[model samples]
Target: MSFKNLPLLGTAEIIGALNLSPKQTAAAANLAHRVTQSAWRRRPPHKSGQTYEEFAAAVSACAWLTMFEVGALLILGRHHDARILTEASRSVHQAAHTGRRR
Candidate 1:
């Protein structure tokens, strides 16, 4: 599958969709912002290393990692929690595709 086609979900949307407490949502957003900013700053110039597809995949992986961390911190360890996460991911994927088509 092409990683470039994957959907990108904002941190706020993920936290809100998961029904996390306001405080938790804020914390997750802050963490995501920090990590994303750091990654961008450390990334090599556009001419070097990975292609755009690879870079996007790396970013998606980072977002997934952040989601997992936030979920763990929020005690989202039940089956229902997994279901919610899956649903959120699917929603984001659909939204991305819809946007692309427009």
Candidate 2:
């Protein structure tokens, strides 16, 4: 599938089309959800601005693209984008991991 087909599909569709492993797909989906939700929560109040949902969608889109790169890197065993993905996963996971400390 091409880039044009990406917007027409949801996370599951994209994941299936890419044939990513279950672990990779799950990480991508989780990242997408987190990015979207985080963007939503950051929606600001201003005279000129995009809605939170819109911001979230844009963020989710970018995250989805990065996720594709992640899957590709993992499949090829390349370390190029792995560090970025790993760092992001750690950051996102930390929110949950440290929740009990509060």
Q: What is the lDDT of residue 1 in candidate 2?
A: 27
Off by over 4 Å in 1: 1-19, 47-58, 61-102
What tens-digit string does per-residue lDDT give for candidate 1 at 56-81? 45666545554544543445545576
Worst 10-residue lDDT window, candidate 2: 1-10
Model 1 gets an lDDT of 0.55
Which sections of candidate 2 miss by over 4 Å?
A: 1-19, 47-63, 67-79, 82-102
Most TM-score-accurate candidate: 2
RMSD of 1: 10.0
Per residue, candidate 2 scores C-alpha lDDT tens digits across 5-50 of 1243565565676677777665555554554556566665651277
How well does each candidate superpose onto the true structure, as a TM-score?
0.36, 0.38
- Candidate 2 scores a C-alpha RMSD against the true structure in Å of 10.6
Clashing pairs in 2: none
Report lDDT (CA) for all predictions. Answer: 0.55, 0.57
* Alpha carbon deviation, residue 54, candidate 2 (Å): 6.2
